[model samples]
Target chain A: MSQQKILSRPSVGAFMSKYGIVVIFVGLCIILSIMSPVFLSMRNITNVIRQVSIIGIVSMGVTFAIITTGIDLSSGSMIALISVVVATLSQNAMNPDQPVSIVMPIAIAVAISLLLGIILGAVNGTLTAFGKIPPFIATLGMMTVARGAAALYTRGRPVGDLKETFTFIGTGSIFGIPLPIWIYLAMGILAHILLSKTKFGRHVFAIGGNEQAARICGINVEKTLVKVYAFAGFLTAVSAILLTARTSAGNPTYGLSYELDAIASTVIGGTSLSGGVGSIPFCVIGALIIGVLNNGMDLMGVNAYWQQIAKGVIIVAAVLIDARKQKRG
Target chain B: MKKTVLVLVAMCMLILPTAIFANGQQEDGKILIGAAMSSFSDKGQTYLQDGVREFDAENDDVEVLMTDAKDDAAVQLNQIETLLVKGVDAIFIVPVDISALKPVFKKCKEDGVKVVIGNRMPAEELWGEFDVYTGSESIQAGILQAEWVAEAMQPEGGKVGIIMGPLGHEAARMRTEGNKQIFAKYDNIEIVMDAEGKWDRAKGMQIAENWIQSGANLDAVLCNNDEMAIGALLAAEGANLADDAIIIAGVDATPDALEYLGAGLDVTVFQNMNAQGYNGAIAAYKLAKGESVEKWDWIPFETVTPENMSEYK
Candidate 1:
């Protein structure tokens, strides 16, 4: 009876693992508030979230991909490809004298970019599922191919002088909240619904838990994997459009190493790299932690080199502390 | 073991860029000049390639064959070897790494191929390897830009902030050195803060926002590149800072930068990519024809502001 009681008792690792991301975020906020006067201001807080929203949205998509025991290294490259392609379609024709002129309606451009992202993502999914390539290798190949394609499309030039109306989607604020943050919130809510309430979401967890068992239980594992990757591609395209609009130009060099940032956020949020257990809320918190750290470091005039070191240290420390209890359990 | 070796070789072949052979064919009657550029993906380098292409189009006897290094030194060396094997008369090279071009220079010397380097400024020790160098001195860009900033800050001088590119980049280091050196000349002009923007519009905007909110007496902002300048401009505007409240200057006078001249941005330095490309190509052509050319043919950096922006256009 005593042994049964001990088995039922929860380990500290289990408790910490579940709540560590939130704890880290709260802890960071408290520390930053103490360090910088403007760290907790409303405008600055909005600034932090606005800056993070692009990468934050990408991290949410990565969370879903991870929950299925898959990865998306192509997010960064896809952003570049989609940014340049969409910019080309929406950009005002080459005009001298007043560069920021009127442009073509961007509705079609947005649709085309989204379609391109979905198709490319589906390609990643198909290669992994049908061709039996590992997710890492398949997405890695896509990453290279997409980046090369973006560079080739523009011949290494920036597609600047974009239409003003389209840029509003990136820069505009509604009710004092920026549109990127709004889009991030909307996507997070939608992702939560898709992951918790839908049958596809349940299948994702099942596949990550045990692929053979999921297959034996009649889950269409191949089709689901494709959908998972395709979804990640779609989210990446959303970020690409927002980023291009915000910058007021699209260059092939954009989104360099962004996938790593997205993955880092996902991992820090306590999404198991080994798969099957994660949540959307924790992913948001994960992205927020990084954003706060960066903003705080900048505000305090931390040396840029030391900031890089600090970032590396904090990410590792957060993951290590969170994982220690789990390892023991 | 043989099967494994064969498979590995095939995989390697599959991954190699098709760019080497894309424009490598030599015509029977043409003076083929190979142009091995550091990166075609770079916006500035693309313009340099265009300058070479313009030079090629103007002369019927000359054909400029260009190969992109894709920012890889080894790949650039491989491309040069292939060019050498095909027997080009002269080569216009924008080295991916100036130091690592020793092999290319040595090989070109052996083949009696005239070599003309562009864009990047090699050290004094390596100047004899190439016949001509057609690009502005990197240090001059920063000096010219900061000279304008020093003047704009006026007699009182006020506090200044700097936004630089990636920390270890050659251009960023040289440009920052020039900016700091010039600012040190004035007693009143004190540098309050500086940050690395990583040459991105978004990151620059973020850093600028942080600096603005820091309550420093910022009178001027100098950025290594125009993208970051524009970012700082946007951040300042977002903070409700007036147009003339702070002076902003950038190195590259990009088209987007030109739009804001005199309106918000004080001044910017134009690096003259067109001159670099055209002059470098012409020098290579002249060298191929056994004509002597200047060892250091300079294309000076020009300041662009509202008054002179039209001249640049």
Candidate 2:
């Protein structure tokens, strides 16, 4: 046992230093499971994963944005806006009276969301890069504009009557694994690849670490920031699609307060709020931590007000740990 | 330069018509009723508009002008001012904030326009000051749901959870209080948790799912609204406990809740919002006609479950 401990010590230390958020998440899961028998059950675990998937996907994009010293508060509102567009297009494509196959609606939704992401991201990018608005103010304005546009688009009514196949992305699972979880996993893998292997990823970190230094080294700082925000927009659109599918309805108010959750997850995952550091996997773990807390608290019969208090406490604790790590470095 | 000119022209086009209409309609014999709506999209607005239209179709002399406050108390105050300037004969307000609108009501009283408060209660003094007060009893909504759960559970009650809206909102407080009162009588009925969903479905689902996962062994859930109840049902379904048949009850007989009832998944209390609107309009018209309107009016409520779900269908 001593020999085993010695052998594991280096990797364990490396993990704690490198992926401390994941370790903390694993610890939280263990504690929750021990405290509530239902937490260990397959059904409850699946439910938790499904619940976390949309936020997880959005957090992944936020991870990218934070790496470049930028933020995207408009993500939640973007989701609402894109979801309305998808819902409208899907409904029109699959008119109940003359119902087309579900594939058409799904395709339309995907296309529209992607296009919207590009256009909205470009707008955000232009404002931050050329218009010279601070990231927070730029994104804050975008957030309100997007949300208001969504509400206006739907005229304050929910857009419903979606095709079954479209809803499947949100509601269905393959081999007992929910589709949203799978989508989140796919996005995570893609993000990991981009961050670890791509030149753009290098540009993001370099610009975040020191924009002037990066520009002195011949990096196009403006372009990189634009790309980062644009990518965030794309991810927001994807999250919106998934949310719409899950609910089977799209209301203008759908993504209210979601931005806070994304930011919280990013921060909890050890992403430096000051920028220049973050990992997709760590962010995923952070989201899972939140998901498990929500699930466990419910299972324990914690009141709603107390659940919010507990969430706030956990976020503060995570931020404190991050601050301590920064001080040590 | 051309673009700027076009923009200016467009702005003027949008503003001109409303300005013209406001100046044109000022007749003494005309019965003008001003409606302050919470929002144009809410069920309240739909019911209120339907009621006004019905009144207009029946009575030729009454012309109803409506403005949506968009759930902003300040905006609602502005709307009241606009109505007052139009010299409306009677004002029917679904106040965005009961207290904030009190001043508007007082001003209307000073202006000598009869005020009819709809779907919400003002302060006691305002109730006496207003011509008619019409709304459903929010406490009764909670009591009715609790009573149903008590009867369903019978001599041996079970664990109950409540998914509420924002704390201190009149409806949320009243419903919660009513439920507390009814549940207090049954020693076996223990409330395990009460969480605010803030009138959000996703939050409600998350709260319900978390509770179920914690092994709380909840036998029933009472939600402040149908949206939260549906959220609880979805959470239960996700947890594969839909088969467990945990009784879920909610206020608001929304179409979705009615459908859930038809599917045998949930029960709901129908507040008859349409009747509230219909009556509010009638009261407004009566006060406008120089007739004495009742000080308070109550609309009927009904309990809907799978047994009588077919009737709603």
Candidate 3:
């Protein structure tokens, strides 16, 4: 009898550890739907998902960083910088006689932005991993630097008048779904595979689980840290591209304080700030919860001030629950 | 010995600059005017600067020194202090926070420097403290926006949704209050919701999307700023709502907002930011010349529609 009881205890704990946040998300949906008749409609659901995708892609990258026992404050500023660069390039400034093909500009813009993100991420990683700066401080410095660069690049002016094809990526739908939503899902899948199936992913968890121990076990800590930040950079680039496309204009001030949302989603997704304990799928769920909360409150006509208070309470509750689960484990 | 030399070098670095700065201010025979700007990033502020520059170029006897506060009141205080030290004859300020600038304004008074306040009014009463206040009333902007919306709705009152700017901001508060006052006058008009968009395009769009999804009987969405107005328009378009299904109006006839107005959005109100700067410079010049300064210089807010769009543009 004691043996059976012990076996059941582990199973129960396992179930709770894996499904706690999911339960809360489901509960929120139920309550919100009960309160608002239109909350559960297909259109609303699609809207919520579409809305979450931008930050959702961001959280996926943040999940990787957090799982490696690091934080990134620069992602928001980096996204803003990328948005302007992409928008400026995508604008047919030349006003070609026949209207140049949209494909070339988009491809060029994506390549340049991705390169910029990777370089910035690499710089951040080098500072933290080699220069002995803490991840928080390193990313914070990069945050200011990146934002300044963005402002300087465009001289604080917003770039608009984007070509039709460029905007299509943001506004277009394939098979009745927004393109951003698809990119977000694809990015999520890629992140999951990286975290679950790749050696780099394994090294990341190892480093995050215990850096000293990871070093003892022949793991290249510096290299893994670099890869982790670079991966985050790639994700930030994807989000920036999508955001620029959606807005059809890029301003230096776009994506202000977005890192807070990305971090919030990661923590709410049941990821510990201490690292080594997050999944991309859970992070997406966390993003969805936030999106749903904001959307649901709007639908219910809740006051904006009250919505802010509720959001803060939910974030605190989520973190507390996560802390408790970790303690129990 | 080495430490002593280092200290002397540092002392000289500091003292020499101040000595030179004092000489520079006194040596010039021209009238010195300093304009502390709130921010230069936005189009409104840029236009305001254009007016300031034009005034400087036109007046050979007056030299205007400009500093951008970048939305920080502390920075504005420092800039004002710098201008005071430079012994400017007069000062023009488009303050970010009026209350935070109280001490600086007092100091300007003690120093006998003429002060012209523009765009944002000081927190305290300005009857004796300031020479002239040049800006439109925030509440007036809101009233103008509502009047346009009311005219569009005509005979029957309709449901209205409000997308406010940053909560607790003076402009946002006054505008919302103005909207409430005007909205209450019409028995047929009802305010269904007032949500904060924090003066952002994305947040405004998200709020409008939720309101639309709620299936509320909304006749119009009024925004505190043009950005939010554009956001609401985007959400409405995304939902495939007809153009006439909802009337949209915003304050500030920004370039983008003008485009939207031209493209068929209902209304926008022009605050004449350039005029405020232009008149503010002229006020400071007259005050520096020891002329009797007016107490208030009110810039009127005009409604912009498709028909009147060309004039504003």
Best by lDDT: 1
TM-score for candidate 1: 0.91
Worst 10 residues of 3 chain B by lDDT: B18-27
Candidate 1 vs 2: which has more DockQ: 1
RMSD of each: 4.7, 5.8, 3.2
Q: Provide chain B's TM-score, model 1.
A: 0.89
Better of 1 and 2 by TM-score: 1
Specify the highest-TM-score model's number: 3
Encode model 3's per-residue lDDT on A1-329: one tens digit a residue.
97577557767566666777887889899999999999999989988888888889988888888988899999999988888777777885643321221324677877988898888888888888999899999999999888877777766666677877888887789999989889888999999999989998899899989999999999999988888888898899888888787766777777888899999999899887998888888999899989999999899888877988999898788767756765554
Candidate 1: tens digits of C-alpha lDDT, residues B1-313: 9999999989777645333433333445677788999988877787788898899899998888899999899999999988876678889999888888898899888878888989888888998898889888888888999999999888778988888888877788888888999999999998877888987777788888887777675899899998889888878877889999989898788877888788778999999898899999999888888899988889999988888899876
Alpha-carbon lDDT, every model: 0.85, 0.78, 0.84
Task: Estimate, for each residue in B95-118, the C-alpha lDDT of model 2 and write its tens digit.
Answer: 888788767777877877888777
Model 1 chain A poorest ten-residue lDDT run: A94-103
Write the candidate numbers in order of decreasing TM-score.
Answer: 3, 1, 2
The reply for model 3, stretches above 4 Å from the true place, is A1-13, A92-104, A325-329, B1-26, B124-128
Q: Model 2 — TM-score against the truth?
A: 0.85
Model 3's CAPRI class?
medium
Which pairs clash (backbone N, Cα, C closer than 3 Å) in model 3?
A: none
1 or 3, greater by TM-score = 3
